[model samples]
Target: MSVTPQASGAASERTGLRVTYDGVVYPAEEIARGAAYELFSADEATGFEWAPRPGTTWPWRRFVHVTEVTEVQGGNEPAEEPEAPLLVPLHRNRSWSSVHQLSQQPAAADDPTLAAVRGSATVRRGTRMVKVLTGRQLAGYVRGWLPHGFCYREHDIAHLRTPAGLAVLRGDGTSGREGTDIGYALRWRAADPGDFDAPVGETYRGLLALPPRDRLGPPVLGTGFVPSSAQLIPEFVTRDFADLPMPANASLLAYTAEGTEVVLYTYQAEQRGWLRMVGPQWRHLLAAVPGLSPDQEYVPTGDVPRSTQLVGSYAGGEYEAVADLPGGFRVLAMTRAARFPVDSVARRLRYARWRGVPCLVLREEAGWLRLRLCRPDPDAVVDTGAQCHERGVYETWAPAPEVTDDQVVDLSYLV
Candidate 1:
């Protein structure tokens, strides 16, 4: 199915707006005013193929609450809303455990209804994706860690503004602690929907099989949703568990017990750094983030190694680029005017082992591979002489030949 925004002036035609559900068309205006609560997907849907208006990020898909629709254009009653689907939660209550056990069965993936609901969760270019962080994880992103692993869409979890409300989504497994009143998250616009994948089907079966001790957070539910008893928020993982290139204007945020959302930092893609956005009143939040100074106004990420980078060809020469997605990709240049759109674009990242430690090859120079530990631990740092850039992030250089099992990874994209 093709997903593309309609050309200019198409949105102004009210007659052109329509929604199709179960093969029936309805006026979008009536749906918007009555049953529709949100847009779910633009792909394979009618009337939603229009682009988001300027300064808006809404995707084309519209989600209509069938039960809420009182009437239809042709006088037919709306279908009953399907029963809320069950998702596997970590806590074991009698009622939930029985259903949870059922989800673990191999045939669960073949359930058509569940599969369709899982497939409904989609990301578009400009959809804001958020990864709820612990204080430690927040510091890693500040230092240079790229977005990877599990994340959620901001649209799905916007109502979860308080620490208590958001605790269910945390990746650090510290949500069970008493008196926990603060939460952190990294939010960025998706450059492409292909960068994400639902944690369902045969490809993700291994994540579900991981032992408790081997994983960091709640066990993968394998039902394509977060492990929450009260919420059915769908979950997504970066494809192949690889890092996506950080886009411009990504924000590091904090949520308080009082439900206040504060912007902690905004990434400056052009400068390769994060500009502190929190004020002195909220500075105390930084205390829990190791090695980060609340007083520092800016932190440079260029020094820290990154796993993925946007490389573009401009004016017959290739240069490192930055993604300002939904806006476009451009050469990473210092002056604003000189930042020309590249003729071609591709992502470049390398993977290899240094001293038996899996590392990301950031760059190569003179037979040396600048490597960053994929999973940094004390022993890994010691083995590779990787210096601590910040908490949990380490980098060092190794001879090219010593970097065994080396492989270059490249993904091309349209300019």
Candidate 2:
């Protein structure tokens, strides 16, 4: 019973993925089975793994996240106790395995103000705030899953106990747009090393501190293959207020809300910063209850620059900025390309059922064909053997390509 981490090229240009195999390689069926139980919500990101039928395409799989797992230690020896969940060893694989995660703070998770950026689609009438929180947490988690390196920072929010919640705001930062994506500002309960000895608390200290660094590919090209666990349980306390003791064993808490986020805009402040997760979601976002500034300041996020490349039809229409996903997929945000109208692209995506999901249809790049898809699918079964002519027709930046469905591609060397 040996476990190892392996990563291969993905189906898209922007997807991050990694594969774990025991003594024997895991069949696609097993991978598909895990999807069913994979905990995708950030607040519920325990990383145990989900069980779903094998997907023809990647949905909420392949990203970066942490799992609080408890396995009996002193292996090769008799089992002394049962498995438990402990906060430790964040998974940095680009592989879809990251889709499976557990939650540390369920309360914040249930709030809708924090749902995913796509909450509008999943959110239904009569939805509670908790469901919304889950959606928002997913957005930031996916962003950290970017194929390249992501700089992780730390922040301190003074006054853990605030008359106006500024105390909690000290340690954390706001995420993305409020009407769209909401985020939370939480601090983890930093535990003592001795605490991990018990099975209940997350084992993030000592020998059990990490989930095997091998799981993270390489520090550079494989950003997902970075630190598996904190060298020590990092303690986070509130900032900017009168004296207040922080929560022990606290590290993160996510919630969503419908208001402007509090940002410590000083560039020097961002220099040695903590994680700032902003996205369109319901969970992990907190609503501006009667307490914190109720009138709601309508400060618009300044214009994000357009991209060098435009995706989809050329007939330019309503478009967002060209967005960059974790893997390698980058396209103007749901906007229209030059010739193709954004409306038609929307219609096609609705027809294709791939509105939010990223994909790579072959397009020309420096004369050679380049695949541009959303977060690349780890262990993607590309059909290169099939002639290039068989590939599907897709619209892309500068170079337009013919879309051919289900072409066999050969990438053994890259694999």
Best by TM-score: 1
Candidate-wise lDDT, in order: 0.68, 0.21
Off by over 4 Å in 2: 1-224, 229-299, 304-415
Q: Please list the residue runs of candidate 1 whose C-alpha ends up more than 4 Å from where it truly belongs after superposition.
A: 1-107, 176-179, 352-405
Clashing pairs in 1: 40-61, 41-61, 42-61
Cα lDDT tens digits for candidate 1, 1-415: 1111232123323334444555655443322123332233434465343435342333453444433234444322434322232233333453544444444444566666556656666777777789988888888899898998779877667656557777888776566374367778899988777778887877666555544543456777777777766565778887765678899999998876544468899999888889998778889978888899999999988677566888999989999988886678998988999899889888887789988988877678899988766654446656888764322235799999887999887788766
TM-score per candidate, chains pooled: 0.66, 0.19
Residue-wise C-alpha lDDT for candidate 2, range 1-415, written one tens digit per residue: 1011111112221232223322211112112112211112112223223322232232222221112212211112312221121123334642223321211222222333222211211211111111011223323322221111111112111211112322112211222223333333322221111111111112111112212221222111111111222211112111110011111111223321211233211111111122322333321233432122222222122232111122233335433212111111122432334222232211111011122323343323463333433222221113221111101111223222333342322111000
Evaluate model 1: give its lDDT.
0.68
RMSD of 1: 11.9
Q: Lowest summed-lDDT stretch of 10 residues in model 2?
A: 236-245
All models, RMSD in angstroms: 11.9, 24.3
